[model samples]
Target: MPYVNIKITNENVTNEQKKALIKGTTQLLVDVLDKNPATTFVVIDEVNTDNWGIGYQTVTEIRQDQ
Candidate 1:
């Protein structure tokens, strides 16, 4: 079984978009690694912008600056 974890900022991601992400990730693994979709696992984590940081600043701060 192959396990994949994906993390993204907690923005207003719709359910349809999340479903597409999960399906696409699984398909990629299937195509590249010959992994079975039935056995592949994909988990999406939505972190608060304040909790997700980059370059010594949180995503919230980065977006604010933008």
Candidate 2:
């Protein structure tokens, strides 16, 4: 079994985008590593900006600066 873990900030990602990510990831694994898609697992973890940091600032703060 192949397991893939993806982490992204909770920035209002759409359901269709998430689905596309899963499909693309699986396809990449199949094409590159010859992994079995049926047994492949893709897990996406959406993390809160407050919980994610960039250097000394939180992602929330970073975005506010931008």
Candidate 3:
């Protein structure tokens, strides 16, 4: 019963990539912590750049600067 929460900015991540992320994360837990894949839970949360902030600036603003 391992629950993992992953947060990423909504920057056009493809479904294939997201699937890989989930699979890899689950495998990591299985390898490191010996967690059961069937009982492992992974949640991917996509937040809009405007809603994700870093160092007093939104991800959108930071990307704009970059």
Superposed on all Cα atoms, the candidates' RMSDs to the truth, in angstroms, are 0.8, 0.6, 0.8
Q: Of the candidates shown, which would achieve the greatest TM-score relative to the real structure?
A: 2
Instruction: Give lDDT: candidate 1, residue 39.
Output: 97
Q: Roughly what TM-score does model 3 have, to 2 decimal places?
A: 0.93
- Which pairs of residues collide in model 1? none
lDDT of 3 by residue, 1-66 (tens): 999999999999999989999999999999999999999999999999999999999999999999
TM-score on alpha carbons, each prediction: 0.93, 0.96, 0.93
Ten-residue region with minimum lDDT total, candidate 2 = 1-10
lDDT of 1 by residue, 1-66 (tens): 999999998899999999999999999999999999999999999999999999999999999999
Candidate 3 — which residues are off by over 4 angstroms?
A: none
Order of the predicted models by lDDT, top scorer first: 2, 3, 1
Task: Score candidate 1 by TM-score against the native.
Answer: 0.93
The residue-by-residue lDDT of candidate 2 on 1-66, one tens digit each, is 999999999999999999999999999999999999999999999999999998999999999999
